[model samples]
Target: MTTIKLHNTRTRRKEVFEPIEADNVRMYVCGPTVYDRAHIGNARPVVVFDVLNRLLRHVYGEDHVTYVRNFTDVDDKINARAAESGRPISDITAETTQWFLDDMAALGARDPDQMPRATQYIPQMVTMIEKLIADGFAYARDGHVLFRVRAYKDYGKLSGRSVDDMIAGARVEVAPYKEDPMDFVLWKPSGEDQPGWESPWSWGRPGWHIECSAMAYELLGASFDIHGGGNDLMFPHHENEVAQSCCAHPEGDFARYWMHNEMLQVEGKKMSKSLGNFFTVRDLLDQGVPGEVVRFVFLSTHYGKPMDWTAKKASEAETTLRKWRTLSEGIEPAPSVPAQVVACLADDLNTAGAITELHRLASAGDGAGVLAGAQMMGLLTDALGEWARGVDLSVYEALLADTRDKAMETKDFSDVDRIKSALIEAGVEVRMSKAGVELLPAAGFDAGKLEGLL
Candidate 1:
């Protein structure tokens, strides 16, 4: 068995992973709000955690690991989108939830063992909030419940910030009902027009942070093996979850190991709608970029670094996949993954390093080795292979070969030039040798563009 080391954000060091129980390795990841389509940036954490999930399952028995990711169906963003579109909040969340599922499936991400919705776990949230209040970590006033931040001595340990420094640096909301400015809301009043559940305090909804804590505790118990999300959630969201969970269940240590992936960029700039660089995963798929290409580009960069998505990288990845697919065609993968590739992944999920080993295997013409190594990293799977198949180049090869033969005899290559140019324009790589012509689809290949070429 290979030893796995992960960078623990809480300890700020790479530590060897040891589950509480060898038979039941558990993990929880903060999921999306489900108010809209998932952007490319949003897909980063999904792919990152999915890889970690795969590693854990591989190390432990397949049925030993339990992975849970939540859906925040109740949020201000969902309410706002519903209000603006004049649609029911339920309708929007349902549609966007399925959209997220479909888009992630395209990227070859397997669903977690458990996916809990915030709305479905409202009773659990209410129960936990009551425990916090009874234990004097929270206070309810004006029909609102807020957690006392300073009450917990280790409040800033995870983020490594003092209370005064956080107040100065963060955008703290000053409300009349709070005992402290840094105190966060566990539950707040919901208006008549908004969605709400009946609670002891009032008809209201749970705050953004409380949902994860409650859902995680109910589904994964008070303590779990791992908790993960993007670094963007480390400050307020994850910090608040730690405070509430620890206060509610002092017997458990919450999540033992914490992991966070870095953010993503687009073409050397932060992805923003104002810069015209913001696009969803579906956007890339609709633009004819295969999901495998997107996943490959992402894996090319280490998750700890800021990944930059570029058209050139996508083009190169597509070309690389095309070559590997041809070489590994009709080949059965090895029973287990390559040791070199697993070593790279076990060392903090060094996907870039694993990909380098894959290149070496492909260069050595080891087709079975390439297939096994690629599958371990969630690449080159059958689900994502449809894009590479169904395009037989026999007809094009025959036509190009016939055209070149006629041109060689007639000493006029006008017809050959026309045929070659047409194939090139259709994004087909035309390889001509003494033996014959071989036409392969490259990046941006459009079968529709070849309609008139034949």
Candidate 2:
């Protein structure tokens, strides 16, 4: 029973969140275009929204939240990559999408309720494009379907940007067929080798922005609870979504709240491949940074604030998480869950505020009380998939037994002492494990450096 407020990008106001249905909350996030690996700069929104997803489920029942993130598999960028690498589009897309999943999983992001792909939903895109054309919101010219920007009166509402301003900063080429310089594509004709579907205008693929609008409408309906992405996507990307969805539906308003997290920078500069700062999530993971550490580093700052991806920050985040994890280990599961975190997360996903409240709980509360506080704060046990208590209890139980067995089986007091010392050094305190010996990842110790001690 806590109140949550989120900043709505469309309204330019922070509004209290009320689910469309009592407990069922639908959230749609724009996902990756699978041309290559998901870079470290690309992970801020992934972690930020994941925290929101965790808080929402804790607030409502876990089953009540339906999260949908889409995959842009048929994009021109992916096609171009395929041609350059001499790989098929499917191969490139599949490889990149799997890499995205693997790296994100390492960051402890919960798998979305549904991860829809554009290619799989081609019929939905085609049907939507046809409706736009029929409804006078879209037109086909030279085997391509384009959205008429001027037709939508409130086109600039989301970004708070005027069409004239967009024209001034326009880096995109104005094609001859476009009705206006600001006009964008709904569908474009495909070449012989690229992926294409049969459509009324031509054999082609859906455009970038249209895929989300189409997929969101098809899966989550016209109005969803929250729509989210990186701030870089605000302008032409999300603005077009608002126009497309509103023009297509014209009945219910699209997502009730629009949440955009700021961009990621490397050492205070924009992260780009040409600048040589471009780094994938795997790039960090391979360097021995814990995914939990990565998640903490992302949540440590305000979502609206641009964060720097640095090794030092990641280490600092790990130390921060270690303290919380140590506090969590002191207490047992409680019958009653804590309520403070719900309100903190509800307030525009203020995870930093939630962490402060957790500090209050750990510093002053008793065992049961501290555990209750941790529950409300939503720290995954063993950093398991966002908010869920990680690792089955049987694992804990078995480890306990193992610790005891180790004590009995080995009469080498020196070895027992060595194991204990090593465990403590690695961050865990060794007692009689459930299976005879139990080993917990030392929350405070240099678990990574423990290998040398052992």
Candidate 3:
């Protein structure tokens, strides 16, 4: 049995992972607010946790692990996007949610066991809020329900910030109706146009933080094995969830281990739309960058480190994947993944290390081993093999060979050079030797451009 170790953000240590029940390993990750397309930054956690989920299913029985990632369909951002687009909120959320699922599926991410939409869990949320108020951890005021942050002694334990420090450094919402400045909203009143539900306080919607807490509780229970998200959510979002959940249920430990992947960057700078570098997963996919290539570039860097998305990396990833695909063509995976690759994944998900091991396997010319290893890391699978399907170069090869023969006899290399240049421009890697001409597709290869180029 391989022992997995993960960096627990709550305790600030890398600890050995142990499920509350060996039969049922559970995890919850904060998912997207389905308002628009998912950016590259948003896709990081999906891939990172997908790998973790795969590893868990591999270790525990496939049916033993329960992974839950929520869809926050009832957010203010969704409301805003609906207002801007003049579309109904339900229509916008449904379209964007399917788009998200399609984009992630293209990236080789397996859907979680349970994807609970916030709207589906609203009754459960209302029930939890009622319990919090009864337990004196929350109160209703001015048609709004706010959590009493001070009620939980260890309010800032997860983030390691005192309430006073948070109030000083953070933007504490200064509402005249609130009792304490640091008090956060559990539920807020919604207008007629906005999405809302009937509650004891008012017709309103759940807050951003409470959505996760409530969904996690209903699906995963009061305590689960792991909770994960981007480090950006560490401060107020996760901190407030801890306060509300702990105060609501004191007996159960909320999440045994916490994991947070670092933020992503583009070419060493922050990715922003105004900077002309921000793009979604669908944008890259539509531009002919294979989804496997995107996944490779993402796994090259450790999840805990800041992953930089660069064109050079993408090109290199495409080339390497093409080579591996050719070598492992028609080869089936081994009975089990290699021990070295499994160990690398177990050691805090050292994916970069696992990739290094894969390079060694490729160098050793062990095609089956390499195929199995890559599949274990969710790469080079048959599902993502469409990008590697070779374009027919036989006709072009014969034409180039025939042209070279004529050039040798007539000393007229003009035609040969013209064809060679055209192939290069079309992203075909041309290899001309005494034997014949061999053409391979390189990165940025556009087979459509070779329509008229005999």
Clashes of each: 0, 25, 0
- What global local distance difference test value does model 2 have? 0.77
Error of 3 at 40 (Å): 1.1
The best candidate by TM-score is 1
Q: Write the per-residue lDDT of candidate 1 for residues 1-454, one digit (tens) a residue.
A: 7799999889999999889998999999999999999999999999999988998888887899999999999999999999999999999999999999999999989999999999999999999999999999999999899999999999988888999999999889999999999999999999987999999999999999999999999988999989999999989999999999999999999999999889999999999999999999999999989999999999999999999999999998998998889888998998889999989999999999999999999999998999999998899899999999988878888988998898899999998888888888888899999988988888888787878767
Top candidate, metric lDDT:
1
Model 1 misplaced stretches (Cα beyond 4 Å): 402-415, 434-436, 452-454
In order of appearance, the predictions have TM-scores of: 0.96, 0.83, 0.94
Minimum summed lDDT over a 10-residue window in model 3 is located at 319-328
TM-score of 3: 0.94
Better of 1 and 3 by lDDT: 1
lDDT by candidate, in order shown:
0.93, 0.77, 0.91
lDDT of 3: 0.91
Write model 3 residue lDDT over 342-391, tens digit each, in one string.
99998888999999998999999988888988998889998998988866
Score candidate 2 by TM-score against the native. 0.83
User: Which residue window of length 10 is worst by lDDT in model 1?
Assistant: 445-454
Candidate 1 TM-score over all chains jointly: 0.96
